[model samples]
Target chain A: MEPVLTALSAGTSVDVLIAALFGSAFGLVFGAIPGLTFTMALALVLPITFALQPTAAIAMLLSTYIGGASGGTVAAILIGVPGTPSSAASVADGHALTRAGKASLTIATATIVSTLGGLFSLVIMLFAVNLLAQVALSFGPAEIFALVIFGMSTICGLAERSMVRGMIGGALGLMAMTIGQDPIDGVPRMTFGSVQLLQGIDLLVAMIGLFAIPQVVETLAGHRAGHQMKIDTSSIKVQLPTLRFLFSYRWNILRSSLLGTIVGAIPGTGGPIAAFLAYSQEKRLAKHPETWGKGDMGGVIAPETANNAVTGGAMIPMLGLGIPGDPATAIILGGFLIHGIQPGPLLFTERPDVIYTVYFLFALSYVLVTILQLLGVRLFVQALRVPHQILALIISVMCVVGSFSIRNSFFDVGAMIVIGFFGYVLQKCRIPLTPILLGLVLGPTMEREFRTAMIMSEGSLSIFSQSPTALVFFGFALLIVAFHVVGSIRSRSAGEARPA
Target chain B: MTTPALRDRWTGLVILLVAIAWIIGSEYVIPSGYSGSAFGPRTFPTGLGILLAILAVVLIAGTFRRRDTLPPPAPSDAVDEPAKVSTRDEMWGAAATFGFLIIYFVAMQVLGFMLATVLLVATFNYFVLGSRSLVTTGAVALGLGVGVWYLMGHLLGVYLPTGMLGLGV
Candidate 1:
């Protein structure tokens, strides 16, 4: 109780509030733009947080995350293009409603439902994270090794179109991390006698490159033909849904939020998966399923609610287990590390105040995002009018500035360009980037734990199997890999059998 | 090469070579010494390299099996595929962007953050974005360069590089 009060005070400081507001506004703008994703926004915002108090920095990041997650509905509703992938499910019904002349109503309902969903998931996260951390507190080196392997396996299996490609991506990330000094031995592994290489690849620099540069290149290339759609925003205004209307779909909102939270809690599954699952479930359960692709408010509510709910759901694993479920949370994990806040089971015992502060700020971000979105819907809508090429150019400059600001190293900026080019090539090959990021985030921990477990057992492999907890996690990892392998084989055989 | 199967095969082959190179590098290039622990520093990288090699082989074998059953699609047939941008234009755009970034990086050292940023922004606006209006372009370039310098340098206390020119915040 005392911790909660202390957290409340810290989270509500004037600087923190202002940072939250700024982050939310920035996220909303970036999220509303079709090419400029919130992931890119988070990457850019990360450097700025270096100067802020930990509480204020976290507040800014959390609000940005929440706002970015929710802000996708604007473009999805108004212009038939989803600002982010999570809002792809929102577009069918959202744009349909816009075409039916209820744009304002759709936006309002999405905003309200997004807030409700975020808050709902925050409550679940608040309870579940603490409980999960308590369970994780018993984890030893072997258990942690097994658990991280399981987490990595799931990400590699599910993050991309091809499981093999995803694994390759993960391996590439792991390989990249091996370039620096060895963690335990302090022996340089692959630095090649360069002083700069001793620090290894900065995760933030890689993230900025991976997420931002491709978007910039794609935008520049694609915008040559000028595919910008002129949206009619003359009649758009915040039209709040009636209490009766919202109450009617209360069950749908609850179920979608629940689904979102569950999907988010999983290691690799994220907003798009959750939003789509919620959408399909709602469509299946609807009284009139045929109206779904048309202008059904339930469709918008389910996906919007679920996607926003992912913000909180993702935090569970990130804060409790030190496992970031997706790219955004991976960056957030980076933020937490930068603040000298090492997440995991120890965080619960060591810094309960920080945990509570996160919770309070997360909930507060929802309120603030809702207000900002409600008042600035028109502003966000106008942002969509900005040309993709210009936006790409701006983001290009930001990428330079953001990377340079990190450690003020020119080499880091050059490294970003190289990694970004590599990332672009990987994208062209249809290799998923998230698994790579997951590998990067988890690589050092995985190595340290594995080595520690080995030493504890004096090079005996049975140490991993001796612990039931470790065995269970290893079994889960094997099961996930086997499942993916079987699924891929079945898909291939089915594809072969089909008449071409 | 445009076909997914063919592309995968090429990618797999490249990755296979990389894996082999990584394994050799880890064994030869990385200094092997008597570490206190049983597992040495080179162990993880070597293991990862082997795993990558196996995965690359699997990927290549999958592509071969697919090729045996169906003819690879022609390049023209890929035109209708969604999300497949114009490769030529994309490559050119990427090259141009990279060139510009390199110039900016070099310029930053000589001209400092503010001037280098202005040049970079102006170049991007005119060349990349195709913005024709001089007033709009100049204003945006100056505004962004000055704005970021002020916000990041003066307000946030981030150390923006003041290079040989020393015209920074």
Candidate 2:
């Protein structure tokens, strides 16, 4: 409180605030656009922040991060296309509401609930950073590896098609991660002579190519406006959820928030999985579970809240442990490098100013997004009215430029074109790309930690099982697998009992 | 791919053969030296090859173990058999995009970023959107090509290529 007050009294610069607002608005627009994710938005904005004051820079980036994560709900609700993977579950009920002509209500509810949830976690995250930092300092490679295993176990929970297929997908991702250099040895194993291959596959290139490019192709090819997606201006009201409803489902929301926070605290798990798990939990707990996929307000709120909360939750590990929470935070970590501020446990002691600025940024995201919600709902919906032809053309160009811009090399553009085509093929074959993205993001880190831990312990499996924290996480992973196995068997048997 | 178990088995065999080729390429072609010596770069890819082979075997066995759900009969036979009709056009479009991309890659090196990106985006857009307006097409092509050039070159400070005229600056 004292630090925040000091910073506030240091002078409230309108310039910084306006810059933050602009960044947030851009993030909002990018986020609402299908295929441009929070991470991509952050990466695009990161290099640009090289020329701003540290406070303004951090503030703008943080606001954009929050805005982008929350903004995905708009596309998810209206077009049945999740703008970001975090908002995928939102499409279930969100699009249903749109089909039922309550698109405005759904969007408003998502925006407001997202803000509240973000603010809630932001406050807690700010106050508890010290304590969380203390806990994070205790984690080592074994604990980290266990956490990765737990994250990988989420494939069982998230696989919509079949558990076996999901495991296969995750295994394939693990294999893909193994394609680069061996972490301990620094041995370049996978690169087949091409200088570009030695640096290993860039996950950003893979992600954009996989998620963004395919969507461009699909939209261009299908080119169908399924229904007239109209937002009733008057219906855009953020009604407070009923007291009775809150009391009834308080436990679930709290649990989901905690789930999101914990996952966020473990760097690289990110928001999509958090939101998916929350929605799954909500569905499992609902009195009428059938209402979930159709159009349940609770379904919309649960994941929205959990996903937004992830912004603050992710910061916990990033600021405390110097580990990035996702591709977005990885870029933010790069921002810290530009500012000559090394982010780790010492960052708090060395530069409380930057830390305070980060806190202020979180608060400002709430303010900016809430205001944007009030003002720009109509404008945003109208922008979505752009014809598919123009949008596809624009996005494809952006994809090419974005890939090339990453490195001065034309090789990256070539990589993007290749990966984009691969993604298209994968989509046609019904292979999901999210797991592949997960592989690219977490793969290298997981392999390094696993191998280093193994070599340190002289190839002993006990290292993964010995530590209490490791053992606990390992147990949780097994429990998740067991639960899914039982659930699938039960569902299959029930299906067998019923008439076809 | 739309064939019976035997056909699917053959497809899996082909995929397995391709996986083997990829493994060989990674092992023989990739330079082994970087930092560590005892366990070099080729270890993981080699291991992955083994794993893939094992998995392929399992897949083959699984294919054989499963009871084949053959299409029952025509609709006139009192049962509406599940239609296995493939969306071949979508598949071909996807393949064509891949082919186009290969051409774009070659063209990028020769024709440069501006021309190649414009042509690629315009051509892909035409095929995908089927937008026939020449004026609209030209505008889109220019908009995309120049927009990318300005954004990457000026705004982001990314150094893209300047082929032939050397006009990237």
Candidate 3:
């Protein structure tokens, strides 16, 4: 109780408040623009957080995440295209309402439902994260190793269309992490006698490269000049839904929010999946399913709620188990590390104040995002008018600047470009990038835990099997892999049986 | 080569070769200092190399089986899929974007962040984006270059390289 009060005070400090506002505004703009994801925004903001206090920095990141999650609805309503992948489901009903001249009502309902969903998930996260951390506190080195392997397997299994490609991506990430000094022995592994290589790849630099560069190149290559979207701004006002109207769909809202939080808590699934699931469930349950694609308010509410709820749902694993479920949460994990806040079971025991501070800021961000989206809907709609080519050029400069600012190293900037090109090539090959990112973030921990467990047993492989906890995790990993393999084989055989 | 099977086969072959080379490097090139444990520094990399090899082989094998079982995609389907950059102009646009970045990196070392950024932005806008308004391009380039330099380098206390020209603060 005392820590919660202290954290409340810290969260409401002028500096933290300003940071939250700035981050929320920035994220809203970026999220409202097609092809500009909040992941990219988070990557750019990471270096700037170096100069801030930990609380303020985290406040900024939390607000940005929430703001970005909610801001995608604007493009879905105004442009007939989703600004982010999570909002893809929102476009069907959102644009339908816009064309039907009820844009104001849809936007307002989306904003309110998004806030409700975010807050609902935050409550779930507040309790669930602590409980999960308490349960994880009993885990030993072997258990942790097994758990991380399970996380890796799930990500590799679910992130790509092809499981083999995903595994290859994960292997590539692990291989990249092996370039620096050995963690336990302090012996250089693959530095090749270069002083810079001794520190290994900087996570921030690689993230900036992997997220920003591909978008820049694709935008530059694909953008048609002088293209402009004409939107009717006068009709796009926020009209608050009546309580009676919201009460009618209360069960839909609750169910979608719960579904989103659960999907977010999983290690591999993320916003788009959760949003689509919620939308489909709502459609299936509706008596008049025909009204779904043609401007039903429930359609906008279900997906918007679920996608925004993902922010809090994702935080559960990130803060409790040190596992990020998606790219955005992964970058948030990087932010937490940058501030010297190591997440996991120990974080709750050692820094309850920080955890409470995160909760407060997360709840606060929802209020701010709702207010900002309500007031500045027109301003954000105007932002979509900016040409993609110009935006790409600006991002190119930002990539160089952001990379260099990390350690003030020119070499890091060059490394970002190289890794970015490699990322682009991987994208061209249809290899998923998220698994590679997860592998990089989880590599050092996996290697360290595996080595420690080995030493504890004097190199006996049975150490992993001795612990029931470790065995459970390992069994889960195998089950996940087998499930994916069976599913893939069945799908292939089904496809083969069809007449061409 | 444009077919998914053909592309996967090529990608798998390349990855397989790279994985084999990585295994050799892990065994021969990486120094395994005695950590007084059975598992050495080279163990993880070697394991990753082997995993990559197995995955790459599976990928290649899957592509072959796919080729045998599946009919080819219709020409219309192939053409209808959005190309990343198929036109000549778009190809040049992609190449020029990369070329400009390489130039910016070199120029940042020689002329510093401000001048190099201005040059990169203005040239990219005029040449690649086909922006004809010199005044708008100049203003945007100068504003972005100077504004970012001031905000990041001066206000935020982040270091911006002054380079040989010594232009940045």
Candidate 4:
């Protein structure tokens, strides 16, 4: 409570409040753009944050995280482009609302729910991180490995069609991870003697290339080809949810928030899975299931709330255990490393003030986003109308600039282009890129943990059997795999028996 | 659009060939005794390659065994999807983009940064964007080139090559 008060005291200054607001606005625009994501936006701003005081740096990044998380709804509602993977589920309902001329309402609902959810998660982080850290402290390498397997298995659940294709995607990602230096050993495995390969591929460059640049080319190829629907601006006004409305669904919101926070605390799983799960549960239990994907308010609320909750949830493991929950957290970890702050158990004791500062920043960011939604909706909607060609050109230049800026190496740019082409090919083949991103982020950690476990066990395979935490995680992984397999079989069999 | 059957079979064949090649190629190069563990440099890759190969074979077999006939292509109005694109057009665009990148890379090597960026942007704008106003294209191209030169070379202290002219950009 004393730490919270100290952090809150600093937060009261107008300078700090403005900084938070400005940072959130920047994040909102960056996230609303089809190619840009929370991670990219955060990476671009990290160097700039170096010049600021520690509290302000954390504030800026926190604002960016909060804003970027919620900003995806703009693209989702307007263009059916899920800016971040977390917002992917929002498209079905959000875009339908757009088509029905309720874009403004959809955006408003998302904004409100997302803010509420973020606040809920921040509260948990403030009060419950100590308790959560104890649970994470007990996790062994075998348990972490099982968690990784569980994450990879979720790829099957996410695929649009076949589980085989999703598994193939996951395999390809795992293979790509093997291209860098061997994590356990100091010896380089796949560098081929190139000096640049020593550091392996920059995940940021790869992500921008894989996700952003491909979209640039795709947009250029079909410039102004999609339906030109006019955005109705009159509905941009914010309408607060009534107290009755809020209270009636309070349990759903709380349940989804809890679900999201728990999923987020688990390393490797984050927003999209949480959002999809919450949305599905909401629909399954609703009185009118048919309203889902057709502009139901609940449909809009569930995903927005859960996905935003994931931001705070992701920070838990990252701060307490030094394991990133997703790619965005991995990028944020780079910032922590840059600051010479080692995030683990020792961090809590070393920098309680910083932890409270971060908590203050995270909580404040939601307020920043809410203010923007009320005041800047018109400006944002107008920016959305920028021509695809111009957007493509700007994004292509940003990709080139960003890749080169990382190490001031032209070689990185070439790598970016190559990865971009590979991404283009994969996109054409209907492969989801999230699994690949997950694999890259988790690859080194998984390998290091596995090796450590092996060394400790003296080559015994029973290390997993010895630890209770490992056993529980292994059981969870097995259950997830079994559930997915059974579900797929049942679906296929049911399809086979369906009337033509 | 290609039939699902054809797509599956082709994907399987390509994956199988690639996996076998990868396995053989990796064994010859990567060392085996980097660490004392049961796994080595080759273990993960080799195991992954074999798994990928087996998965490919299963997918191909499933493609053959499954007899659920796909419905005929829907009418254009009923589909109401994004505009139907010709594969030929997409390929052409891809090839042109690749060609442009190669030209940009080589030009950067030979002609240096400033001149190359200007020419590349101009060509891309005129050729790719299909802008009719040559004056606007050239002006914007030169403007961006100078901006990048000043920003990256001078402001950021990056040592961009000055080419044969030695203008000290």
Answer with 1 or 4, whichever has the higher TM-score. 1
Please state the Cα-based DockQ of model 3 relative to the true two-chain complex: 0.59
DockQ versus reference, model 1: 0.65
Cα TM-score of candidate 4: 0.81
List ranges where model 1 is wrong by over 4 Å.
B67-84
- TM-score, chain A only, candidate 1, equals 0.98
Per-residue alpha-carbon lDDT of model 3 for A297-323, expressed as tens digits?
Answer: 999999999998888999998999898
**Candidate maximizing TM-score:** 1
Q: Could you give candidate 2's per-residue lDDT for residues A1-500 as a string of tens digits? A: 67767566432587678768867886887788765576666655654465566776677788788888888888888778787889988898988988887776678767877876787777678766777566755767787778667766664344434444444445555566665555665656556556777677765566557656776665544353222234333444444445675566566667767777766666436788889988998888888998888988778888888888888887876677565656577566656765777666667766676677778777877788778865787666565666654765576656665666666566877888878876676555444555555555556656666666766777677887778988987898889778877886677678557655
DockQ values, each candidate? 0.65, 0.32, 0.59, 0.31
Of the candidates shown, which would achieve the greatest DockQ relative to the real structure? 1
Docking class of 4: acceptable
lDDT of 1 by residue, A1-500 (tens): 88889998998889999999999999999898887888889988998887788999999898889889988889999988898999999999999999999999999999999999999999999899999999999999999999989888888876666788889989998889888988888878778889999999998899888888888888777776456667877777999999999999999999999999999999888999999999999999999999998999999999999998888899999999998888899888989888899899999998999999999999888999999999989888888877777777677778888899989999999999999999989888887888888888889999989998888888888998789999998899899889988988888799878876
Candidate 4 lDDT, B65-117, residue by residue in tens: 66526663457544664445456656755665555655665666567767877
What would the per-residue lDDT of candidate 1 be over residues B39-131, giving only the tens digit for each residue?
889999999999999999999998888744466756698776545667777886687678777888888888898888888788778876778
Q: How would the candidate models be sorted by DockQ, starting from the highest?
A: 1, 3, 2, 4
Q: Taking chain A by itself, what TM-score does each prediction score?
A: 0.98, 0.72, 0.98, 0.80
Q: State which docking tier applies to candidate 1.
A: medium
lDDT of 4 by residue, A128-191 (tens): 6776556665667777676556656654443335666666666666667777677667666567
TM-score of each: 0.97, 0.74, 0.97, 0.81
Candidate 2: what lDDT?
A: 0.67
Question: Tens digit of lDDT per residue, candidate 2, span B1-169?
Answer: 3534565465446546756876787678656755443334565566656655665565566456544455433458644422222355455445544555566667666778888878877776576556687777778888878876775577546666666666443
Q: What is the lDDT of residue A247 in candidate 2?
A: 60
Candidates 1 and 4, the one with greater lDDT? 1
